[model samples]
Target: NEVFDNLAMFAGYGFNKSHSAAYGMVTYQTAYLKAHHPVHMMAALMTNDADRTERVVRLINETKGMGIEVRPPDVNASSLDFTVAEGAIRFGLGAVKGVGHSAIEGILQARKDGPFLNLYDFCERVDLQKVNKRVVETLVKCGAFDSLADGPLPAGDLEALGHWRGRVDAAVATAFSLGQKKQADRDAGQGSLFDVADGLEAGPVSYPEASPWSDQVLLDAEKQCLGFYVSGHPLDRYEEELGVYATHTTETLERAAEREAVKIGGVVAELKERRSKRNDSRNAFLTFEDRAGQCEVLVFGARYAEFEDLLKKGEPLLVQGSVRIEGDEEPRERKIICDKVQLLLDAREELVNKVTVQLEADSLDEATVCELRDIFKKHQGDCATYLRLRVTLAGQAHFKLPVEYSVRPTDDLLQAVERLFGRGSVSLG
Candidate 1:
């Protein structure tokens, strides 16, 4: 308590020149090491955060991004903390959610005599009580046991792969019984002490596939290691369509808002509702994005009334309006708000951000609207804007104003428009 009181000391003052110089030197050294040897740097990061599971996962991704191949945590090779060997980083057993240091240490100690040849060999050597099926399964899912397993099980065979997990415990129990029998043999002096080496069971089974999964699928599996999706984002599937309506990627959107009007698109990541200071009914926030990136949408009750339909998460919308730099009155510079969403389509977002449908000047007939419906249906993001084109058929001048009006701004709508109209006709604005 006395030491704690002295250490508190109401925080501190600025650093001296020597302190600054030393700090600068360390910072420069770290930066240089990171720039030149990112894998090693990330391995060190993983080790430092051994007790912090979440950060350890992040560092693992960072290592992979640097092209450092991570050796899965193996019964034969891993330690409690992440280690680097021969320019490769090993997964840290301590990074797994349930397996703590003591449990990991127990497994590592078992490996000291020799490497685990297979699931059976590991079962014979390691203590199951310290490390259970749940712990082992987590390692397998994260690809930590991949080296020992040889290769991953077949695609979609993940659940069936549970068989190998049970093998470890069964093999260990069998090895214990053999050791007891050997003890009896030794006491009788009837057996040769130095004999032929024993063999291990086959590695975890491999499955048939023409090729490994696509990068997108592999990256998704990697996300199970890290809490958040790291490699390619979910929006990567429809980059062309998302870019049509989205003003900018979330990361880029944070930087500027010069344009008076902009269209930004994103998958609806999340939505939340809140009450204003005055307890007014309408206050909400939304986070979504396209492959380029993502952005947030904020709406107050008054604003929400008009844009309520667009506020939903995962909705592909080309929102047009002003970008106001909020909190600019004070010292802090903040985001520009996207005000008034004109069109939020229910369907997939396409390359065309907006749709312009042409109608004959004189025809309000059902046939004309029916034709418009058929044409608009082809669009992705289901977005459409109707425009009447008046031209002479030589007999009658036909004109039609929209009696009922709507469009689904979807990704297909954009692509369909590109096919029907010229590429430039369906612009985001």
Candidate 2:
């Protein structure tokens, strides 16, 4: 009777030899292709599931792991499907949230005629009905129009990019109006009756220079549109502070032995609230992402309540936890059971002892000195501030001078000092 029961169970679960062989062969082929032709394979994978934002984000991380870059969507270069370009995968326009198939077709058709010279040219050519203001905003946020910009942007200048983007966006309506008027005049084969003998030149449309958005603002915009940071992780700004506190990065956490105690810092990328099965108390799961990658953190019961306010999306967090590796998984295979949580800014404040600024002796004018004093006055705090004045003459050494009053060593204060003196001029000890 026991043998009969075992036979029935095997019959219910087993597959034929031919079927097993077919499945194995297909898996082998896929693994072989992925190993040898990662770019092509990833492009196909991305193209196939372009509509699923979460899946696209995961695949994008996978592509990065394979050392393949995923370029932002380009109005001039992108297609309906993800395409291999310059050894990288360019994001498909169809995948962009507000962009639709009609817009993709129109953009492709317009590009076929000639590459768009600028935002004005794009507005003139593409079908506005399909590609509206909302679509343009989304494209700008995701860097689709980057190639069409006036020149190459400085790396690590997302704020500058944001400022420039705001100006360009503010000018879009006027540019579109001018472009449309020109097209209308051409179609009618008649210049405006008041037009000058020399074909009317719409003098270059100019935009008022605007202040740059903060780094967090830029990253938030990226998060809104692309479901992840494409240019750089938000935690990148706090790398130095994180290095001081974190024992392991997300990548290192994965390679660590299970149950190893670790401290990690990252911006909260995702959060889900749940009720515990046993006690019905509120618990939370968070996806924390640093420059290296992301890891999952579990906050249960009392711990969840303690850190609930700090669990905001886009906020940076420092977590003390232990590694929790489950049965093998392909993507995002590591987890953390958080023991303690603190805001990353709070951690920085506790770790940093002093702030230092560097200046050239010759450049320290009376006006500059007043501005420096005002900056210090603006941020009165407990952390001591020091200045290093560089003397250019040979045999004259730089000297350090400590200010009598200490100032608060907040991120805002650091940013303000950096902005006035330029980055790399300010340091925290």
Candidate 3:
């Protein structure tokens, strides 16, 4: 009798009347808000995920899919939390890695006075002890200091701004030092007593000249600061080159059929390694990305062994894989089961048709011709080489001259050509 009563009790069960009604109302309200106020809902969602970086990246991508732009962290406009500005989402400074809560509070407190005029103003105003040089450097690298120098800089303040010739690092360092010295003087009660001119301002500080950082270096620094790419992807410049070798981009995986073979090209963004449970064979799962989006690639067994040497972070690669689907649903996910991989440098030789160097007739001389020949000889391969000359006469005349020898379309050769004739003068078709 007791066993029968226990089975009957399990057979009929229901929630409390009040609890069921409350849950149903809450569910309906949530659904209504998500359906009606998607932007506000996403803003709340992102704000709730402030402490989680990977979640932020995923949400940023989701925001992009919804046609909303997420601007980089800016000192002039950002707040303690993510805020909507000018029809875009502004990244919160608090989300920046290596930036402590104290530093963020200090920045916000300082900005309450007014917008920072320049790098000097920023350094002078903020509590450098909490927001020190390292934190400032990270902010600058992630483009938080960009708005300060956007407009025309004041006269005699170029060195203070450090924006002259892209010497931001040197500029920021000098500004911080000046601010530190000023603070020390104030603390020590060492105000200038001998000054005949009490209100005269100091002259322009001198800053060293430095070339701008290359795109790759800048992007790497951004990734370190923000935990993902914001301004641009590393593979952005190679989009044209990849079109010839890649059958699909990471963004196109949605329409791809499961088990269909496809070729993709991207820079390796992340990699994870594990040992199999059965035989302890090495395997890995990698995340690679192009300008379009990022996708995951699984490398196991012989494939892992074959490409282990090339599977490095930030390396450009072309991968052959089969599409995989998780479920038959409206928002189905697609991943790649990597079968083969090749370095982009190697793919260039097989994909390029010819290297064309465009030059003006006035610039063409015996030395120039000999130098071009030397460059071609250094990278000898099967890709044909050509010279396009623009001659100025009664009317503009163009001449297409073929080189006697073919050369490998290597990156070094392309860079050399660009250096000789300036950028956009070299092309590979």
Total clashing pairs for each candidate? 43, 2, 0
Question: What lDDT score is found at residue 169 in candidate 2?
Answer: 64
Compared with the true structure, the alpha-carbon lDDT of candidate 1 equals: 0.55
Q: What does each candidate score in C-alpha RMSD? A: 13.6, 5.3, 6.3
User: Tens-digit lDDT track for model 1 on 198-251?
Assistant: 433333433322233433344444445533343345454345455554566555
Q: What TM-score, over all chains together, does every model reach? A: 0.50, 0.80, 0.75
Rank list by lDDT = 2, 3, 1
Residue-level lDDT of model 2, residues 179-276, one tens digit each, is 56765665688665555432244334456566666677767777788787866666766777677768999888867878889999887878999998
| Segments in model 2 whose C-alpha atoms lie over 4 Å from true places | 1-37, 65-67, 172-203, 208-211, 256-260, 277-280, 323-325, 328-334, 358-373, 387-400, 403-405
Q: Which ranking of candidates, highest TM-score first? A: 2, 3, 1
Off by over 4 Å in 1: 1-15, 50-79, 85-91, 113-125, 146-225, 230-232, 258-275, 280-429
What are the clashing pairs of model 3?
none
Q: CA lDDT, every prediction?
A: 0.55, 0.78, 0.77
TM-score top scorer: 2
Off by over 4 Å in 3: 1-41, 150-166, 171-173, 191-206, 326-332, 356-382, 385-400, 404-427
* lDDT, candidate 3, at 397: 51
